[model samples]
Target chain A: MGDPGRDEPLAELADDLRRMVVETLCHAQAGHPGGSLSAAEILAALFFSVMRIDPRHPDWEARDRFILSKGHAAPVYYAALARRGFFPEEMLQTYDELDSLLQGHPDMRCPGVDMTSGSLGQGLSVGLGMALGLRLKAIDARVFVVLGDGELQEGQVWEAAMAAPKFGLDSLVAIIDDNQIQLMGDTATIMPVEPIAEKWLAFNWNVLEVDGHDPAAIVAACAAAQAVRGRPTVILAHTVKGKGVSFMENTHKWHSALVTEDLKEKALTELCVREVR
Target chain B: MVEMVAMRDAYGQALVDLGDRDARVVAVDADLASSSKMDLFAEAFPERFFQIGIAEANMTGIAAGLAVMGFIPFTSTFASFATCRAADQIRVSIAQPNLTVVIGGAYGGVLAGKTGKSHQAIEDMAIMRAMPNMTVLAPGDGVEVRKAVFAVADHDGPVYLRMSRDPSPVVFDDSCEFKIGRAVLVREGRDVTVITTGIMLGRAVEAAELLAARGISVHLLHVHTVKPLDVAAVAAAAEKTGLVVTAEEHNIIGGLGGAVAEALGEHRPTPMKRVGVADVYSESAPNDDLLQKYGLTAGHIAQAARSLMERRAAHAQP
Candidate 1:
């Protein structure tokens, strides 16, 4: 299982995801572009290569669970879910529209969404519950929860952090998208969650750091997490706020922005150029 | 004809029974294990029990996590801390997803004498009832509490069980059955109805006996589950008596009074009076004195019933 050569091709999947994010946000005309783009690679790797889930049976009892804790980045999760065949790819256009299953936030009512998680700092707790639930039932399924760097500011997250190791929830893994930018401004300026790895380690979690763009490294961290016992794992994936798009990258303004015709064209061109590589 | 038992002791005994039968049944407490009777569970199954040091929010969140993992978690803490401190977590984490997390709010209402207003949870029912997918129960006595413990454990989803601190007299016999969303008529009468819940039910029974001597027949309805309130029974009692009196050892603004009013207002609009603490913070006093001062005793309920009867009689005249 540790054979690095066995890893699937993630670049192609990331390219497809980049295209989906651009197309969905363009079609919907609304979404959090910066955060969604920043976390695209991590989402791609989890859905395509790591998580053990069946697209055909969304509620499979033994299937692994994934929670998008930073629900603002739902466009990325929706794109991955659609590509995995959880729903019709056409539903991507309905993002944030009234009565549409696809809202700005991830809703559990949607087929592949494990929990409703637009509210920050809550998805971790929900994921922890699912992990504990699996342990009690003697199920082998693991729980993977994605958290934004900004979401770590909430006190509830720390509260949950203290409990994970104490309960010996080794089946749980939290991946933080450390983009260094929040809604207000740079995360360091708004509320510094500096020394991210140290904080999780202090809380007794087995912390792993990786480059957000490197799918191989992300998969390796997940594997390392699975190898451990007793303590839960936290993979601190360092990322740029908006990775693919030149204009949006590292800009907090794009954390959530309208997709104008010009902006959409520029984003699509950048993604298309990357897919060609 | 219903026998009574304290809900707190029943909760402890039921937890021990659940732990014995199912390994997935885990008990988590915020340092009130002895008072809530969770000591029996802890001693019986050390591995399954967790003492989560005075952190109510963390306890609730952890229980939510345990439930999601397929563990049946019963979280015990003082009523005020359980409901007020961790309300947001309860609403979002547990109730929202409809997890099987049983919250035992021991020492509910004025029963926590000497501890005063800070410890007493007068608004727990109101706070929990507001959330969707939550089942709220306040058992009448020790026997009903035990039955309620077993019943809630068997049921799925989120449940808030409010229990008393002090030991109340056993009012229910072993033969008396308990079911969620059902009300039991402790004593039947037609002249007036006294609908009560929790420890206050005992006082309401006493009030009924006293009213019988005064030639005013009193009907006693013990409402165990407060949220899915036995509306039909309350409506039936109201239709028969044309007068209703609600009693509870909680704030008059919510709790039993609010539930009874909400039910009766929709179905049978009868002349009603509520016997509970009148929206004021309680001062430190002995448990009995506190109950009497807060208008939560038999005499207060009887007086409220009499007033409702008087109002009904006035309306009956041409």
Candidate 2:
């Protein structure tokens, strides 16, 4: 995993963190497990390896910004924020609960969240605006956006896609958590955004791709994206919905539902074993 | 008398002034700078202007994002697009979070004349008023429009500034100070009260003059800020004048007239008449012609006030 001294391997950390995702969902008794599980490594790479963010000072001016455009996958974001020390890890147990800091979707009131987002396809435009505003203020900070495959069907995403590179936001990086599944079914069947990389390329974005579940690949791909100049970058990550759990893998049933105590135990046991990517 | 001018022209000048005052204030347009009168702002600060090219939703979300970064963005376009087309985007991105994003609804109300009903936004005030954390405003003329623009910029949260494209008779002097939620008392009389908003203030003022000639005393209140409507001022007028006639260049429902009626209904319980477009779409005509056909002219307001006065007199006779 090319882990430098004084640390654990990236894949091991990502694989271990999958517990928090299911635990958050299980405690809440409702959430999107499919998308959250699929984007674990991607989020791990962003919060742990790639992004220059300080959890203690989540609102730090010089720190990087992260916007979860695909907000329904909030379980993963909440999990990552907790693990990264934005808040108490125990707070994950209160997710989706009334009066809890963790909301059903990503809300900026919670620490480490840049933009409050739930409605699809709007996050990219905001990221575009933030990038432009940052450039105007002479802030060299980077803005990272996480979008879902089905979320690409939103017209606002395309509107944002056209604008980012037009402004030449090389510091802006958009990672499409392309887990293949949408809310109802497969993304290709529902909307057909394939040749997605070419579409971004046509929009003049610097394009990259990686296995979304592979932590090291996710980190390396983001590094490559940041290296590009004079253009925004989009990393299309291929992943299976519900990647960790055996029966839930590539299935839409786990997109959102209760993770009963029985299923939670099985899922946690399955994710406990360290898997080399 | 104040110099007659268009609210749109005043808005452009206000932006230029605001550019000098607040560097955080940025303008985003959907490629209708000339119509929205944002060309002045663009000319003054080229680097600050963002031309989004007819994508209203994109403009709103972009502004919301900019607002998150401490820029007080003023997103401008026709009222129809600013309020209707990008409503969800505005609601989710700006309004819900209560960002310091100012929205300019240029060509607001039926004043978009000749461009027809599609461009007219009679329900803009209604739509914006419904959103939580949204400060909705409709300035009547050039002097007040400038004040309203500056007031909303200084305001803390999200605001929607409804601007008229039609040139109107200026009703306020340069010294007129604008407040966000307070009603400005333009004229005072004893018999009846004429409450109006947007371009209809000119007509209401004219109506007051006509009523005075006919031996009827007409009090006039110009309501520029619709949401956080100065209900206290409205209740005071309702208590004093007894008979109330509300006017606006918008639908009689859910706008200035509606807000006044609702306020008076709850507080003062005064007999009132609403003078505006009678719950219908506007047709293609000159601005004045449209105002005439929709019964939004001075004559219409005078007639409404007269009828209400006569009703009050008849009730008094008994």
Candidate 3:
């Protein structure tokens, strides 16, 4: 993996992707905006700086894969893919539309999508499978997964955690967007998954802690995860529920909600998407 | 008498043959390697086998991942755990995306005689057949099991292979071909049609012989694949006999009975009767005793055939 130098480019792309997430969800009028906004840095960093993907050849065997384990955050994932030229930017508006490939969650039908994931706690296993598949083919490519903090409550995540270490999958990295909020309410009250780092450590995973919104920090965490040997790494990315949007940040209401035109305008203007365009 | 061979035994031999033939054929088990008959494959290719202990959900997830990695992973376990326990993992990761994974659910239906009702998967066929991309197969005997296993490996998509614990009497010879979704015409008769799947085939064959002795000609159709139901053949059977009877070692509500009823209801418009456990949790009994208690024996099937014929004849008079 290269240094992925120039965190400035990733930061710039993160802002653009955040705008896209807001705009796409607003156009759809329904989606998980909170988690989407929270995962902006992770998606931008992976697509723009980290993952080995070619827009022209999405099915290239040598390409590294990224699975959105917290699949409700499709808006953010789609925005990153579109901006990375996997498909035309115009297709983002057709999200959740009738018969649109832009499903409410990540679908493999779209270009650059590795595995179709939306169900919580399943992606880490899928990514691990792909990583192993790549290895069998003598391809040195790795798998990167982005999961939600609330999703960690699922038991299969730990099952995957247990298997990855035994298999010695250093090329697999799972980053958790620990936004501390879920659909119903805050995670601490709903399901206290605190002592999270130690929980992963107990499962024999190499854990990395980082501020999820920091582009440079996210890049470094990914690199650190790759450098490790004989085990899988899970980066615990602490983040605000709704990182960029002022009204939604750290609140449970925006875990998923209909984006009114007025709220859309405010979010877009704040992100300065018009200036970038 | 024809030889009695367990479907799982056939599956074990099939997996060994597959292991030798295919490089990518890998087996993953949830501590049921020996029971599910995957021990044969494991012994052949130790490195290709992954014994994940007793975690069905993890086994399923890992199999799906291995499938993506370019390995044709055959995950095996008890039918109940494979269908109900790890259902979501199989549905979301494997079914929705149409992953090419073959899941062998051993001791399917009521074949696990003494393991209690929970181990018997009466609702498994219904559960798996409900999934969009799943190909549900419950072969009649060892002959069909060997053929079905290789067929599923070549066929693309999510397939659930249901195998029984006890040795079902051989109903077909090697000359009999097995094809997914195509109902085989076991014995052609003119009076009434007996449709069955899995272990019920042996009982149905016996029932047909019994009916033949009574001067009642019976049309028998063995449906190995439950899902992608062969509605055309069922309709033809319904049209020919004007009456249908379905049998299985499962609940009558959603297994072979339900599939045949649904098909004849829509296409053929024939009167049908279901013969199986009457929607109750089966008890731990000897396999033969359980069959007799559950109204799934050869005698019960013969009785169902006679009763359906009497009903049809009486209705004609009225």
Candidate 4:
């Protein structure tokens, strides 16, 4: 609602992101659909509007860096990267296959992935390192790390949290996809990280929150984070575990399950995508 | 007496020198800067030094990120924490991407002395050598430690540089050539071969002298690089002497002893005896007493060589 002119296209891109994730997971028959679907808008907003990157030169020295720390949601990351012209969209068909550039998790071998990440609680630390390196080189750039709420249980995440503020890394931003569910069950049932905003504020970070499915709000939040100085930022995005389809929404069953052909058709119909096959 | 310099001090000085030469070189320490001797580098380049509190896992992950951004990051901590505490971080962040990050593991082996089993890292070499794309280096003396620092900086992949806490002995000089994957033939003899790695080289050299006094010829090979081991050199030494002895200040299981045995087992089967800690945790003791108790002193090496020679002689008579 911030700007209808720009918001309309990003909303379209968000739908395209969700459709591609469903299609990619359908082809692989094995992926984490719940988290991938939940992150559609956040990925769409960053790849399309918030980030400064060149699709052709993914390794440009001065380009802004992005690391998918919750790397299990790799399908959505690949879709967004492909949609941004980092690679041909057709490569999505080879996701998770042997020798495929689209690995089950994000790998640096694939274009547009700044760092190879799959392990949880590692991305924020890596982002802090990148922020430090970029500052040392006098490069004007930012490092963005996307994390999962459930992944907050990892002690290393708090270790990084305690260190980033000490370094005064204003160029680093961490986005927590508060999708509520993990591989086991809801984060509240497994291990609660509730009071999430208070936790970040206590750790000396500039905290922000938004409806994760709202592309306009995500863009605004990212811009606000960029404007902050002297400290890192953490944006808590409230989202459903499975944001789009009917049966899969807010369920852990689709956290890392196979998407059947019929389920794929139903999901595509919900996202308003014309299924090719 | 041979000139003595602490391996940690040499490693620290090497970092300072590297920082002076390359602007991209940086150091990360996990709150053990003074103990690990990384404070020397921190003092030299304050802007490039990063003290990551006491979190080894976070420090390692941060180093990986620095490596990704084209900076050569050296992370230092005690061997026990560097390898075991941050193991998954090292494996996933650095080794998986084959990043050019050097891990400085200080007080490696039981030579952290008097600190007891918790501080010692007798299995560090085995742990690092097993990781894919990891280059493991256990320098024997001050000169080799310095050379290894510059070498791993220029190297394109991950490397773990194991160092000791105390000053023991200096076995090599600046003129001594040190290269990754190339074992140095410190001495050549005919009767028996005593292959040594890390600080054990000093005792190995002394052991050779003892054998010489007893009219026994000993061949000595000093292996500074453990992974991508010089298999050809090990095989040739075993082939010539027909008797081999591996001496190390670590558990004989999966240490240099195990590596040498595996190489010789495939290339040339020979009569062998491993001289090292006998796969048991050691208690707090003085350095000398611990070395003697674990059969890692020069005398123990000599005994192992003599026993191997006796076995060979007995076999020949039969």
Best by lDDT: 4
- Model 3: what is its DockQ? 0.67
Report the Cα lDDT for candidate 4: 0.91
lDDT by residue (B37-80, candidate 1, tens digit) is 99999999987787767678778877887786668889989988
Which residue ranges in model 3 land beyond 4 Å of their true spot? A1-8, A273-277
Q: Per-residue error at B302 for model 3, in Å?
A: 0.4
What TM-score, computed on C-alpha atoms, does each candidate reach?
A: 0.92, 0.96, 0.96, 0.97
List the lowest-lDDT window of 10 residues for candidate 4 chain A: A1-10
- What order do you get sorting by lDDT, best first? 4, 3, 2, 1
Better of 1 and 4 by lDDT: 4
Native-to-model Cα distance after best TM-score fit, residue B34 in candidate 1, in Å:
2.4
Model 2 docking category = medium
Which portion of correct inter-chain contacts appears in model 2? 0.75
Residue range with the least summed lDDT across 10 consecutive positions in model 2 chain A: A1-10
Count of steric clashes across candidates, in order: 16, 0, 2, 0
Tens-place lDDT digits, model 4, residues B239-318: 87989999888889987999999998888988899999999998789988999898899999999999988887787894
Q: State the fraction of real interface contacts model 3 keeps.
A: 0.68
Task: Evaluate residue B302 in candidate 3 and report its C-alpha lDDT on the 0 to 100 scale.
Answer: 90
lDDT string, candidate 2, B213-318, tens digits = 9998888888889999999999998887898999988888988888888888889888989998899998888877888889988999999999998888888895
Candidate 3 C-alpha lDDT tens digits along A18-43: 88888888888889999999998988
**RMSD to the hidden true structure, all candidates:** 3.2, 2.3, 2.4, 2.7
- Candidates in order, interface RMSD in Å: 2.4, 0.7, 1.4, 0.6
